[model samples]
Target: MPQVFKDFAILFKYRNFLELCFAVLVSMLGFGLIIPLLPIYAREMGASGVYLGLLTSLFGMTRSITSIPGGVLADKIGRKKMMVGGLAVYTVVMFLFGVSTHLYHLLILRACQGAASGVVWPVAATAVADIVDPKDRGKAMGFFSMMWDAGIAVGPVLGGLAAAAFSMAAPFFVCSALSLASALLILKRVKETHKKSEEKPTVSLEGLSFHKLSLIGICVTGFTVSFAMGVVHPILPLFGNEVIGLNEASIGIIFGAMGVTRFLVKPISGALADNIGKKRVIVTGLAFNGVFTTLISFSESFTTIMLPSVARAVGLGMTMPSINALVTSMTTKEKRGRVMGIFSTSRNTGLVMGPLLGGFAFDALSVRAPFFICGFVVFMGALVLIATVTEVENENAEIALS
Candidate 1:
């Protein structure tokens, strides 16, 4: 126990880690503030059916398109530079979201927002990977995840209140301000993790030979989970409002409940992944998420909906840290940014497809159809992971570089 405290003390001693956590928290706060409200805003702008899904997918598509390039730039230029630029873009785009008068305006702005996110998330993840020891990566990532979830937990309730009290545009303005503040914090407090190098790190298939198969498996799982999420994202608010008869505030509470569950569970799951095995925790989480996400469709009331959302949060908390740590374990520090970029791309791919498919399903079949299909997709991903992925320890990770 004393040693554990000491370890945590040492981890916190890194100034960059603390700053990164702060940045992520603030940025996610802004992001969460807007996410639940975006679809409604679009619907109000006369977007429906496939257009609604396209609105969500455009953001993901742009992000997915830019992620690899952003990763390469992070490795080439630096993490801090990429992050600063991304935040600047976020500030502009979010404010634009406030004044968006048409579906086309939203489509353009969301695409830009995705591009900014492409730069921010993968690079920040790499920065975290750089600062922490390999053995403690899961815990470090868990802490980071906790911060993000914490922001997400609080943002929606506040956003909901602000929107109800004022107007739909209010949250976007507030989020823009928050994003600017986060950017300033990054510029002032966070140091560049990637050092300037004359000889660039070789990023080839050969370098990843040791864990190529595992990486592919992880990416596949990432896609599945994200795709499932995407399928639900655009329609959840609508479902709550139309089907479950929930108000904006009530819907916000449900979203907050999920975030709260993730915030509370991530640290514990991270510790478990480190002490037990990542694969075990990941498999368990995936199964839980698959089951509960499907159950969400059957929910008739706000209370019933919260149960599955909370359960899904637990599943995500368990899966995320382990997957992040696993990916980091499979690659060298120099190539970490690009590897993370690939991982982000995989997630974005699902993000892109999910809403598109969900929109179609929502229009064609039933509001419940997307949920059932998404649940099945996640189940298949879990099966693939169980069959193909093997746990790679921190001790063995160094050998992968050779």
Candidate 2:
């Protein structure tokens, strides 16, 4: 117990890392509060299956388009500036999301929110990479992952209870307030990490350079996982309510279960990746994600649903840290923001397509169909990763010592 406390003390010694964790925690908590309820809110506004999917896709599309620019700007301008500006926009947009009365209102607000998100996440991730050593990158990312998921795990349950006790709009109000608080926290507590430089970094796209191939594999893996998530996101609440006959609180509990499992698994998985090999952990995780996502289609009740949700969480927990660490390990500090931006763009590309296709699948076929397609797509992505990616061995050891 003393050793554990000492380890934590050492980890938190990086003040910027601690502050960034707080920022992510509050920001993600706000976002998480709305996750389970958003589809239901759209449904109440008379959105059909297709419209619901469009709402999510539009947000992703906007984020995807802006991510690269946001990354470049973070490198050029400053990470702290982008994060503060983005959070302010996010807070206002989330407030407006509560006031929206029509599907079109949601469409516009969600797109704005996505743009804001593009600025915040990639920049924040780059900032995290800035603070930690390459050897400790996996552990730092894991702790950061834990904080975000912990907030997500707790937020849904609270949001659901608030919605049930007051009104659907109540949770949105809470989300907006928390977002505002997070923005303020970032403004006051976080320091600028990116050193402003006049020279622009050039990223080459030619040949099968080890860096290029690893990046490609990471991006593809990101797309596949997010695609699966996007399909499930808009559909799951409705599925729970309509099929399982669950209430708002119950649906929140189900979503919370996944977050909880992710929170529990990330640290261990991250350590394993750091100690063993990133490729091994990433491949195994992707396999699990693909399998369990398919299994979700077969679930008929709340108890059964938790099985897949927990399994999917394990996969995410394993995949995210390794992917993040790999990306960080490959890039120089000067180019980290732009590279991570491209990384975000790749994941958002899946986010863009997943819902649009999932929506059509739900409307044209059945609720279960999207899950099957998502699973198959992710499995293929895993195969691509296996074929393309090789672990960075000696280079990482050198970085750790440096």
Candidate 3:
């Protein structure tokens, strides 16, 4: 390996990060299983469209609602212990999903699961951030994010297949088993990356509330763009079926192709974010995202969609790592968990709000409404990037050090 390549390998060689990644990947698998199954699963119990949307948003809402508290808990209790507890709760709630006979039952269970999920991700990311050197932090986080995307990608196919070949319950069962199994692995294999025994900083609601103003801007830009993009989401398969004249298989192929861009670009972008500058990567990524996102909406043919889809894929993959890495980089060791927790919460807020606005824009206007909205939002993100934030070098990470 090249010297630089060898350096990255060392970051992974630390057994604890891999343990954490394994746990996250497994948890994501369970999450992936639910994405394709949620609507149908609810419908099987007599839920209406409005009800289903509510059920869907329940998870996002809970995740958003509980994230800051989860962070506060992680900072208090420590990351590894919090992760284990969160995963255990996730497994139990998912199993409960299998036993539920009513839509409301599903909603309640899903909300609890959401709270647990909210706790796990940011804490895990912070744990990884704590252990990895600043030089390798972006690359490490990229790989972490890539694993998640890969899990979600692989999840739907397996979930859909299980739903078809065996039963709807099959996917849920598989998810539960994998998650609990991952939790055990985490408990056994992962060491505490952030030891609580260290000189723990005095917990302050004031400083611990790191990056609130910045997060507010990020959330606004995220919600505006993502909400617009989400409108096209529900319409994509519909467009393929009704207008574009494609079968389920072809639609899947196109969707899968576009999704590939996200995983492919994340790690490379992470490394780039650390190397060049976090804010620059964030701004450029959003700009690139704006162009490709526009192209995807306007694309006339399946082949044309691929062009912009690839661009959007790479853009998101790059943007996520840069944005998240930058966000994580700005805070301190003691307050890192809480900062990331709140950041993740803001993002989940966008996730819930995006679909609603996107749907309204489409039903009242046009099928392609979301794309235009997404493009506009990305432009706003670019503006936020330019006006508000400044770039900091990763190697000289003294700013983040206590």
Candidate 4:
């Protein structure tokens, strides 16, 4: 425990951790708050599964599609400006999401909002990776996972309760407040990693396409599963309400528990990945996750869900950090921000798609069918990685960035 505490303290010692975490918590919390509310709001507005899937997909589609450009921008302009500016747009867009008059309008806003994420995340990741040593990427990735776990833990339950108690719109407004706070924190507390005087783009040794292959595959894996996750993020609450007859508080608790399991195991997974190897960690974790996600569709009782769903969460927690560490291991300080931006964009793009696909599945098929589809995809991703996406053996391996 003391060693754990000491390691965590070292992460805090880095200024990048402070700012990067600030951005993640604020941004992810805002997004998390809105996720549970999205289905409820859509149903109230008479949206069908297809429409909701379109909406969810629109968010992912926009984000995923723009990652390469965002990566280029991080390389060209700088990480800080891109992130701060994106957050600024994010704050405004979220407020608009709350005030949206029609589902169509909300759909458009989410797409545009996805762009902000596409821009912000990669830059933030790049900034974090910029300062850390290559050998320590596994540890740095663990810290990164903690930030996400914290956001996931707080966002859904808080948003669900707020929606239950106040209104669906309440969480968005709260998210906006947090965004404003995060923006201010970035402006004040964080120092820019790249300065104009110091900005010099260097060509990476591995070349962009090949160097980032594994990471890109990880991105695709993330996106595909997230597409499945999107189905659940919005519909699960609806399932709990309309099908299972649970209250919003109950829904929040269940989702929050998923986050808790992920949070609890995330650090351990990252550590294990560091100790073992990224490839082994990823394959095993994804396999466990894939199997359990399918089981989520079968969950009729809370007791039935406890272990299986928690197992799925643990699998997810392990898979993500290992993949991240693998990617970060190949990046360099100069190209750090841009490459990271690409990684973030890729994963979030999947996130954007998940909702749209889920929404569609809910309308066209059964509410639970998408989970099955997602599980199958997760299995395929595991197979694909095992087949093709070989992990980098050497930490000092450099990729061609230009």
Top candidate by TM-score? 1
Error of 4 at 245 (Å): 1.6
lDDT of 1 by residue, 1-402 (tens): 753444456347666998898899998998888777888888887878689899888878999998888887888888999999999999999999998888899999999999999999888988998888877888888888888998899898888888899999999999999999999999999889988545465545457535788888898999998898899879888888878999888888888888889988888888778888888989999999889989999999988888988998899889888898888887777778888888899999999999999999998999899889888999999998998887776566575453
Write down the worst ten-residue block by lDDT for model 1: 2-11
Question: How do the residues 1-402 of candidate 2 rate in per-residue lDDT, one tens digit apiece?
Answer: 653334455357676898898889998898889999999999999998889889999888999988888888888888998999999998899899888888888999999999998899888988998888777777778878887898889888888998999989888888999999998998998889878857565444432123678778788878887887788779988888887788999989988888898887877777778888888888889889889988988889888877897898899889888888887776667777778888888899888899988889988999889889888988888888898777665355444533
RMSD of each: 1.9, 2.3, 3.6, 3.0
Model 3 clashing residue pairs (backbone): 227-354
The global Cα lDDT (0 to 1) of model 1 is 0.86
Model 4: lowest-lDDT 10 consecutive positions: 201-210
lDDT for 382 (candidate 1): 96
Report the number of the highest-lDDT candidate. 1
Model 4 Cα lDDT, one tens digit per residue, 1-402? 655666676476676786687668766777767666777787788887667767767777787666657666676776777788878888998888788778888888888887887777767766776666665666677777777777777788998899888987888888887777777777777777764434554333354433566666766666655655676656667766776677766766777787777777777776677778888888888888888878878877666655677788888888877776776665555555555656666566667667666777777788788778778878877876776666664443553332
Task: Give stretches of model 4 more than 4 Å off.
Answer: 195-206, 209-216, 341-356, 393-395, 398-402
Candidates 1 and 2 compared by lDDT, better number: 1
The residue pairs found clashing in candidate 2 are none
The 0-to-1 C-alpha lDDT of every candidate, in the order given, reads 0.86, 0.83, 0.69, 0.71
TM-score of candidate 2 relative to the true fold? 0.95
- Badly placed stretches (over 4 Å) of model 3 are 1-13, 40-52, 98-101, 197-216, 219-259, 294-308, 362-364, 393-401
Query: Considering lDDT, where higher is better, how would the candidates rank from best to worst?
Result: 1, 2, 4, 3
Residue-level lDDT of model 3, residues 1-402, one tens digit each, is: 553454346446666877677677777766676565665667668764445445546666788887787777777778888888888988888788877887778879978987887888778888888887777777888878877877776676667666667777777777888789888988988887775634454434355434445555655555544454554454454445445565434454554554456666776777777778767777777887778777766666778766776677776777777777777666666777877776777677766666565556555666666677777877876787676654445444445455
TM-score of 3: 0.84
